[model samples]
Target: MREWMFKSRQKLLTAALLLVSAAFAAAQDGAAGIEEANTKVRSYFEPGTNLMYAIGAVLGLVGAVKVFQKWNGGDSDTGKVAAAWFGSCIFLVVVATVLQSFFGV
Candidate 1:
């Protein structure tokens, strides 16, 4: 009975060791996965920035049209509205550019 208990304990220990080893191996794969993700994100970054710029351009044009209409209508809040739209467009472009510059990606 004692020998059987010892054998069982050894088997339990062996299984635990194997599980730990497998976990470590899997952790290495996670690092590789992260690296791959980083590379993919960086590859998209420049084009993403360009897309942001394009979106900003489109928004600016739309904002201009809206502001133009407001100005023609003699709306008192036209300046405020125009400023809000212009600020938003600038923010989008600046954020994208700053992120690229900060990350160096």
Candidate 2:
């Protein structure tokens, strides 16, 4: 009976060791997956930056049209509206440029 109990403990210890090793292997695979994701995101930065610029351009155009209509309508707050729109467009451009430069991408 004592021998049987000793064998049982040894088997349990071996199983635990196998489980730990498998966990470590899984962790290594997760690290590889994370690295691949990082590479993919970095690859997309240039196109993403360009997309931001394009979006900014579109927003600027739309804002300009709105501000022009307000001006033509003789709205008293046209200047304020124009300044707000212009500020937003400038902010977008600056953010994109800064990100590109900062990342060296």
lDDT of 2 by residue, 11-84 (tens): 99999999999999999999999999989999999999899899989999999999999999999999999999
Per-residue lDDT of candidate 1, residues 3-29 (tens digit): 999999999999999999999999999
Best by TM-score: 1
lDDT of 1 at 23: 96
lDDT of 2 at 29: 100
Ten-residue segment with the worst summed lDDT in candidate 1?
A: 96-105
The lDDT per prediction is 0.97, 0.95
Please identify model 1 stretches exceeding 4 Å from their true place: none
> In lDDT terms, how accurate is model 2?
0.95
**TM-score of every model versus the real structure:** 0.95, 0.88
| Clashing residue pairs, backbone N/CA/C < 3 A, model 1 | none
TM-score of 2: 0.88
Cα distance off (Å), candidate 1, residue 32: 1.1
